[model samples]
Target: MEWDWNFVRQIMPVLVQGVKITILATLLGSILAAAVGLVIALGRRSDNRIVARSIGLIAEFIRGTPLLVQLYFIFYVLPDVGILLPPLLAGVIGLGVHYGTYTAEVYRAGIDNVPRGQWEAAKACNLSSRQTWTRIILPQAIPPMIPALANYFIGMFKETPLLSAITVLELMNQAKIVANSYYRYLEPITLVGAFFLAISLIAVVLMRWLEQRYGRIEP
Candidate 1:
């Protein structure tokens, strides 16, 4: 079908709303993923073998499975067992937890990259575990992690389209709705692609800035 300016104008508002939801999901999911990853990273490093192994296994399981299946389990299966999350909330959880496993490795690598001398010095100074991590190790480790973590968040943003499977009114879903209603795929699909391309470019620019600003580690 020929491109229709009028249909494009008519659908812009709906697509804009979808864009908002998509961004909201990405932002919330990224935050949750960061927090979850840190906890998993720490847990895997725990002195308790049980805790470490359990956490490691869970992380590996998550990383091994498909994200779509996880979303289905969270959104569909949970409701059967007395947990009923709204679609958006469920989508966010799925995205966060799935990506969190991958981010856990990034966190582990970052923490491991800290000099052994730093840990020894912390011990030599008789610093508490909390104090050592907060005051020294994290400060050194987290800077270089920013670039890698930012890359994962960008990946999460692209993966937001998967939310449509769970009934999220994200950009792709909105485009599909418009396309289905009008029986014309070209305009809405093209607009959706254009929208994603524009936002992804912007995100890449921000990621570049973050890499330059926080990806460096000082001697």
Candidate 2:
């Protein structure tokens, strides 16, 4: 059968709207993940062994579970406990928490890469803990961590398709709706792939530029 250009035009607007939702989910989720990850990373480095161990266990639990399962639990199970969230909100929470665990590890690695002497020097200079982190450690750690964080942002974008499982009207969810309505899978599925490819390629280029600008020194 010949490609239906008319059908393509008809679906383009809806699909573009879906793409917007997908991007928004990714953006919001990335912000949550970055914030939560930093908290987890700092907690793991806490002087209190109990706090550090407790945070580590929590991170492991998040990282070990499937994101889809987490999404289901948050979207479906939580409602049973009277914590009803909208579909998209539940999806973003799942994505953020699930991926936050992974981002925590990346942040840990960056902080670890800071020279040991830097911490000692800050201590010797009697810098407050906040000052040590804000003025010294983070400045050194965050730059090298940019590429990894961007990579996870792209990963989160790709994972937005999973949001469809929870009834979020994201790209893949819209494609499924269109396909079911028309019984035509080719166009919508192909469009989903093309959109992901385009966005991923763009992210990779940006990440490369970031890496070049702020990459850590290598031996």
Candidate 3:
């Protein structure tokens, strides 16, 4: 069949809405993931052996599980226990948590790269732990991790289509809706791919800029 501009025009608005939802899910999910990952990373480094080991095990378990399974459990299983969450919120949590485990490692690597001498110097200066981390460790640690974190954010963006399984209506879901309604799979599906490719290429370009800006840490 010939490409029809008329049909594309009809579907553009809905698809754009889907694109917005996709970006929203990624942004919110990345924010949650960054917080959770930092906590998990810090917890794994706690002075207490039991706490450290427990947190490490939990991070490994979550990282081992598939993202889709985590999403299903969050969106569907949790409601049975009366802890219901809105679809988008649930999706972001699921994405955050699952990817958070991975980002935790990124955090750990960055943190570990900070020289032991830096820690000693901070203590020598009589800097409180809070001042040490807030002023010294984190600022240095976080910059190098930005590229990896940004990569995961892009990965999460690509994975937004999985949120559709829970009825989140991201780009893929919207594309499916348009195609199903009109019985023309080609245009909508193709446009979805176009959107994903266009955005991902843009994200990669940004990621490169971030990598250059952040440089690298020696772990």
Count of residue pairs whose backbone atoms collide, per candidate = 0, 0, 0
Worst 10 residues of 2 by lDDT: 210-219
Per-candidate TM equals: 0.96, 0.96, 0.97
Question: What TM-score would candidate 3 get against the native?
Answer: 0.97
lDDT of 2: 0.92
Backbone steric clashes in candidate 1, count: 0
**Per-residue CA lDDT of candidate 3, range 1-219, in tens?**
778889999999999999999999999899999999999999988999999999999888888888899899999999999999999999999999988888898899999998999999999999999999999999989999999999989999999999999999999999999999999988999999999999999999999999899975432
Which tens-of-lDDT digit does each residue in 1-219 have in candidate 1?
677899889999999999999999999999999999999999999999999999999999999999999999999999999999999999999999999998888888999999999999999999999999999899999889988898899999999999999999999999999899989899888988898899999999998998788773321
Query: What is the overall TM-score of model 2 with all chains considered together?
Result: 0.96
Report the lDDT tens digits of candidate 2 across residue range 54-142.
99999999899899999999999998999999998998899888888988988999999999999999999999999999999999999
**How much lDDT does candidate 1 score?**
0.92
Worst 10 residues of 3 by lDDT: 210-219
Give the Cα lDDT of each candidate. Answer: 0.92, 0.92, 0.92
